[model samples]
Target: MSDELPDSIHLVLVERLPNHIAVVTLNRPEVRNAINPAITSELGHVVQALNADDVWVIVLTGAGDKAFCAGADLTTVGSGQLDDLWTDDAGFAGFVFAKRTKPWIAAVNGAALAGGLEMALACDMIVADERSTFGLPEVRVGLVAIAGGAFRLPRVIPPAIAFEMIATGQSIGAQRAFSLGLVNSVAPAGDSVTIALELATRIAGNAPIPVRESLAIARRTSDLTESELVRMSDEAWSRLSKTEDFAEGPRAFLEKRSPIWLGR
Candidate 1:
């Protein structure tokens, strides 16, 4: 069904100059973008394909304006179909639980709760719609969140707030999330994806190697011990010194011109 040209409802991938940005959308907007097993499996494949194609960045969102993603499809919850749908990567909802070498952005278009929020947390950055809301309602449903929600939530927001969200199932507004530093940006509803793409475009203009390396170092050193931080910083500095972009930066500055980064 998604065999047509660009802008398919299933998954849309586009190339913009020096960058390739893949947008994975939750196709089932009729059910508030609830994710089924097939969607999950396809998500894994899509991510793999994008990475293999050397895409510098990826932005994931839902197909409609009403919701980015509600959560796992309730219809498949008890059918044991959800388990089978997961790819070998164990990525709860595609790339959320998988290891990715590149940077990703979660353009949260609307209501992002439970698995949806988990998916956003998995991304390197999150930009949400002003009308969007976030929560973890698994406790209320008598089920634990299995999609990296528990582990990732605490890391994104204050520990107490994350715990409270999981325990009370309280949904927070987009402004509150942005204030907590959980969301990178809050755009007008229905404009979240546009703002995200704008941001991605800016990011894609820079050298790709540094972007990936910086993300890797930041994540690695986020909660490091003193010794580990020292080691990581030393190694990262040494590694960056070896890149061609490292030399191009200073030369460009001295020459009063824009850098022509080779991303080497």
Candidate 2:
């Protein structure tokens, strides 16, 4: 897999893990893995490639323990080149607002500020280091977190707390983020990526068809009425029931053996 990837992919590292999980590392640790046009473009390409691959789960993290991502490269904030960072299909960083059925987890190794926090918020789940911090400090610089931070934050945590964090431009500790349900779990220092991979492995062990269908329906109908959600779920189940894994699960349970999933 490494050899298949381009030699020019210096901004990000893509590793194919066991159990069909892909780990994508933001490699610019010298600047706290800050997002530049190069990073964004490389990351976008990686995500797009993985989405089409056979991988079931993706875990994203930074290269070093000092930071997950400090947000956009402020040095390029006003540079005309930064405009290239945005993709009509993937939004910022290529993951946010991207139409994806597979799950993604953010392994926050350190502080995730502004666009960084938004990137984490874009994932289905987040696992942060115990010493890590999260915040939307864009307000301090006369900017707002337009990369899904303002909207996703309020939905994940309480609206008031999300508002406070966005408005005050202050950061919150990992423990606080866990309490608010913003982070799925908190790992020991330097173990965030490990824990996130464990979580991804668990998800990958499930029936891929149902897992993807469930994720698609949940994300699509989170704002819909109960009846609408039920209708969607019913429709999804109708299709899922015809899948090979649906029959394999019952046969495996009856045989008291593990199912061999074909991801059909």
Best by TM-score: 2
TM, every model: 0.88, 0.94
Candidate 2 residue-wise lDDT, 152-214, digit = tens: 899999999999999999999999999999999999988999899999999999998788888
For candidate 2, the per-residue lDDT at 14 reads: 84
Q: List the residue pairs that clash in candidate 2.
A: none
lDDT of 1 by residue, 90-208 (tens): 56766676778778888998889878888888888999999999998989877787788887888889999999999999899999999999999999978988898888888877878
- Off-target runs (Cα >4 Å) in candidate 2 are 1-8
Indicate which candidate wins on lDDT.
Answer: 2
lDDT of 1 at 8: 43
lDDT of 2 at 83: 65
